[model samples]
Target: MASIRISCLLMGLLTVFLGTEVHSYAASFGSLAHTASATATTTTRSVTTTTRVVRKRTWATQSSNKAFNINMLDMCHRYGYNVDGQFVVPEFMKLLNALNRAQCHMASEILYPRDYCLSIKDEDKVDLIVIGSGTAGSLLAAKLSDNRDLKVLLLEAGNLPLMTSEIPGLWADSIGTEMDWKYFAVADETFGQSLDGKKVNVIRGKCLGGTTAMNNMLYDRGLEKDYLYLESIGLTKWGWKYALKLYKKSEDCKFEKITTSKTVKNFHSQGGKVSVDSFRNTRTLGIRQSFSKAISSSNLKTVDYFDVKNHRGFVSSIAMIKNGLRLNAARAFLTDANRKYNLRVALKSTAKRLLFEDNKVVGVEFENSIGELIKVRVTEGVVLSAGPIGSPQLLLQSGIGPKSLLNSLAIPEVAVNERVGSNLQAHASFLGMIVSFETQPLKAYSISEMVYEYLLKQSGPLANIGLSSFTGFIDVNEDGTPDVQIHFYYYSEDDTVFMPSQLDAFNFNDNITEQIIDINENNDMEIVGISLLHPTNSGNVIIEKTDNGYKPVIKYGSLHEDDVTTLLKAIEWFKKVLTSEAFEKYGPKIVPLKIAGGPEPNVDSEEYWKYAIKHLTTMNVQMAGTCSIALNPSEGVVNQNLKVFGVENLWVADSSVIPRIFSTESSAPTLFVAEKANDIIKNQLGCKGSNESNEDDDENENN
Candidate 1:
C-alpha cells in the first residue's frame, strides 16, 4: 500500500511534466530536455488525438555548484523514479516535494511526536515484549511479530538511524553523538597505558539497529571452536554445527566477487536480510592484493577466512554494506513489511526496571520519550536484548544479581545470582604497528570530488569504511585452531595529515589523534594490529550506584600469563609480515610504542615487547560473556536456554550470553545468537509463529 502511494505520487508528477510543450519548457527551465520517444494516438471517428511522452534529462553543465539539481538527480536515480520526457512547472514542484519527503524521512525520527504506546490501557497486554531495539532485539522482534495474531512490542532507548549514519564511510561521525551510549571501561593499571592512563571509551549504539548501526561493519563468524566450547560448557545447542545454520539464515551474501573455494561457497548464504560483501573498488582491491601477498610471502597461505573449516589465512574483510550504505540490523530485519502490523516500536523509551510477580517477569517499567513512567504488561514473556553492558545493569537494577551487591546499593534482592556480571571477556588488542609509505598523488580531484562521488554515485574512497581491506586469523599453538586475529588498516596520503570528519565515529583520544596526524604528515601509513582471540584472562562488569543512576564498572584486561604469552606470539607474527619481501618495497617502519609514564620501548627487545603488551593492550570492543550461559549458577547468570538462572520467563538474547569471546569480531556472532534465540524463545513459548513457514525453522528443528 505504501509502495502504491509512492508510485501514484511519482506518476502524477510525471504526467504533469509530459503534458507541457517541449520548446518553451526547455527555454524557461535552463536546458532541461527529455530523451524518451513520444507516441501519438488518434481516433478516426471523433478525430481525437493524444500524445504520450517519456521524460529523461542530462546535465547541461559540469559545475559542482548545482546542489539542488545534483540532489534531485541523485534522488531520482536512487529511488528509480525515472522522469522520461519534457519537464513542466507542476512536475518540477512534485519532484521537489518528493525529494523533500524522502530527505525528511531519512533525517528525522519519531521520538515523542506521537506516542504509539500511549493508547494501551491498563488491562491491555502484549504476547511478547522485547527490550532494546538493537542487534538481537530488532531481529527477534521482527521474527516474533510475523504472526499476525501475536502482539509484539519493541522498545528502544534512542531514536531511528540518521541519514548521516546510513553512510558506510561516515560511521565514526556518530561516535559521540546522541546515537551512542558512550560508556567507558575503567583504565587497566597494567595494559591500558597507551590510552593515556584514562578510561577506554566503549561505544554502543543506542538506536534501533544497536551496535550494528555503529560498528566497523566487519562481518565475521568466529572460529568453530568458539561455539564448540559453549557446547562443552553445557550449551549443547550452541555448537558450530547448529550455530552455522543460524548464521546462514540471517546472512544474504551478495558479493560482487566470490572466492574460488568450495568451502566458502558452501558456507555463505544468499537471499537473507543482511547483505555481506567485500570491498570491490580499485583502491580497496589494490590494498587487499598487497596485504595478501605480504602475508603469503611471510609463510602464511591466503584463503577465504569466512570458511569455518579452513579459517587460518589472509583474506579481504567482508562487511555488512550494501550499495555503499550500512545495512544495519534494523534495516535487515525490521523492514516496512514487517512493521506493517502486529508490531509496535517505541523509540526513546528507556527501561527502568523489570516487573516481576514472584519469580516470573510480568512486565517492564520504562520512561517514555517525555520522561513519563509507563508500565507495559506482557502476557507471554520478556526478552532483554539490551546489549552486554545494559543487559547486566538492568538485571542488577531489577534485584537479579549478587545479594551482597544488592545490599550495598540498598536495593531489595529478588534473586541472588552472584554470576550476573562475571566472566566478562573481550579481545585484547595492541594498535602500535604503523607502516609508512612514500606520498603519492592518487586522486585527480580534491576532497570535494570524493564527497560528491559518494553523494551521487556512492563509490570512491568514501564508499568503504577506510579501516582495512585484509584480515588474518592465525594459530599460535601450531594446532588447527587460530588464537590471534589480525586487521590491516590503510590510510591515503591525505588521510594521515588531516583526518576526515567521517572517521569521528571511532572516538579516538587526543593523544592517538595527534599520533595519527604526526605519522601521516609526509607519507601515507598502514596500521595493523593483532588481538588475542581466546584470552584465558577474563573481567567483570559491576554496577556502582550513582547519584543519578547505576553506572557500569568495567574491569577488564589481558592480565592472565597465558594471555601475555599469546599476545607476544601474535606480535611476533605481525612483525614477520611487516618484514616480508612483499612489504619491503613500502619501507615498513614500526611506530615507537608510547606509554603514559614510560619512555619509548626498544622495538627489538623482548622486555620492551612485554612492556608494550602490558602498557599498550587495548579492548577490541568485542565484549561478551557478562551474563554467560552455563549450567551452574555460580559460573553464569543465564542458563543454557539464555534464561536467567533464578528468574522465570526472563531471557537475555544479546552478546552477554556468549560464554567466551570468539576468534573474530563479535558482530556476526552476536547476530547469530539473536537468530538462534528467536527459535529457542518461540519453542519455549510454544507459539507457532509465521517464521515456521521459512526453511530456517525446519533446518533448525532438524538440527
Candidate 2:
C-alpha cells in the first residue's frame, strides 16, 4: 500500500504519453478525419482500446528519475490487482520488497555490497543449521541438537522471551509495540475506514516465542465442520478426526474446570509442554449473575466442549499455563534448558535468504544483533520459520517467485517458480466497547493492593493478569466453516482514555436499580470484540529494498464481500447481546453499547453508524498462510511434511505452512506445526515418530 502511490505515478505517466499520441493523431488529420467521421470514429475507438490498457489500476510508475523495471512489470502482472495485469506487479513488489532472503539473508546483496564480497573467508561451516527459533524451527533444533551431535545454528530476527512482561495478557498491554511487525492493508473501500480516519495499527508480533508468546492462549482443536470443509477442498488427513488425533498427541492438559463456564473448550493430554489450566483467579458476584442471565436469555446454554469424548456443558477457560507460568513454543521445544554445547539460539538474528546450489537448499544467511552479516550452512535443508511476512519474501529471494520479480531486484533467477508467495491469508480484529466507565472491579484493584496481597502470599491481584477470559464459537455459514466469531473481554481499566472511545457511546446508556431512583449513571465497562474469521481477503507479501530492516511489506488482503457480511453479522450479534436482559440488570441506563462513542440509539442516523463501524475495526496479530503446506503440491507451497514443494531440503515450519486462517490465535497452532513437523523430519532421518503438526491456515484456503 505504501508503494501504491509510486506505482500510480508510473501508470499516470504511461497513460499521459498514450494520451499525447491520441491527440497527435486527431490533431494531424482533423479536416480529413472529420469529413469521414465514421472512419475516424472507428480508428479512434481502436486507439482508445489500446490506450486504455495503460489505465488499468495495477501499473506501477517511476520515481522522479528512476524508470520502471521489468521486475516491477512482472509484479504488476501477478500481484497487482486493483491494478490491471498481475504479470508485472509481483516483480515490482519484489523490487520494493526483496523476496525472502536466505537465513542470514541481507537486503539486495548478501550482507554486503559487491566491494565487500572479496574480503570474506569461505571457510564458515556449521554442523547443522535451523532457520528460525520459533515453533517449527525451535522444535526441530531442540530435538536434532539434543544429543549434542554437532554445532547447531538458529537464526531469528525477532526478540526472544527476554522479559517477564513479554508474556501473553501480562499487563494486557503491548499490543502494538516495537515487537510487532505491523504490516499494511491493501486499500479497500469496505475496510479502509481505519486508514482514512484514524491511523489504527495492524499488529503482528516479532518477538521470540514469536507470536505465540503474545497471542491470547486459547487452545482449540478446531471444529469438526472445519476439517470436513478442508476435505471438500481436496485436502485429506486434515479432516476433524485426523486433526483431533494430532491435537491429542501434542497436548498435555490439567483439565481445570472454568467458572462462569459457558463453553468448556476441550484440551488433550495430561503431560505435554504447555500448562493447561482454568485460571479461577477472580470474578465478581454481580458480573457473574449478569453473565449467567445473559446466556439463558440468549438461549445459548453454556456447554463443556472439552470432553474429548463428549462435549456438552458449561466450563471455564482451559489456558496453556504450566504452574501459573506460560510454556510457549520456544520454551517447550527446547529439549535442554541450559547452554547447549552444540546449539546456538541467535537472538535478534534476522534471516535474509536461503543459500541454494542447483535448486537445493544448502543453508541460510542473516544479520545479527550488531548489524553484522553472518552465514550458516544447513548441510541438509533450510526451513523458513519467519512466519507469513518473512517466509514468502524468502521464497522470492531464492528466485522461487514469479520470474519477472527476481529480475526487478536485480536478483539472478534461480527458479522460475510456481505458487511460492502468491496466495496469502489473514484475519482482522477491532478494539470496541459495549460500555466503558469506572467499575467496582478497578477501584478495588490498586497496585498497592497487589503488592500487599503478593507480600502476604502470591495469590491475589498480583498473581493475576487483569484479562477476564473470553467466550464465543466458530458459528458457520452454509459451507459449515465458521465465518464470524465474537469474543468478549473484561477491559480492566477506563475505555475512553485507553481506547479510541470516539466510536460507540449508546451501548453505555445510563440505567438504575431500585435503590437508585434516577437512571443517569455510567461506570461499569465491557469490551465486545467482533472478528471476521475465514475472511475472503487475500493480499501479497514481497521483499522490499536491500536494507530497510523494517521487515517485509505485506499488503492486507481481506474484507471481500463475504468478510464484510460476516463482520456486519458480528456487529448485529453484539447489538443483540447488549439488548439482553443480563445487560439490562447491570446498572447501565444506556440500554446498549454506543457507536462512535457518540450519542445513544437516539442518533438514529445511518451515517453515524457507518462512521462508528469504520473506527472500530482493525487487523489482528494472527497472520498465516504465506507458505502453505498441503496434500496437493500444485496448490500448496509445502508438502505434507512442511517442506517446500519445489526445493529439496528446504521447508517452512512456522505459521506460514497453515493453508488457511484458523478461528483462533496462531501461536498455539504454530507450536503444533513445529511439534508435528519435527517428527516428520525425524522420521525422514530414520528416527522414531512422535508429536504432530498441530494447526490450520487462515479461514479461506477452502475457498
* Per-model TM values vs. the true structure: 0.80, 0.70
Model 2 per-residue lDDT tens digits across residues 359-474: 88777777666677767676656667777777788778767776676776777676665566766776666444355433354434422233224323334543444334445553
The lDDT for every candidate, in the order shown, is 0.68, 0.51
- Model 1 alpha-carbon drift over 4 Å, by segment: 1-124, 256-263, 337-339, 439-445, 496-512, 593-596, 689-703
Residue lDDT tens for model 1, 591-688: 76454556565667777777766655677768898888888888888877778888788989999898887878788888888887888787777766
Residue 620 in model 1: lDDT: 70
Among these predicted structures, which one has the highest lDDT?
1
Maximum-TM-score candidate: 1
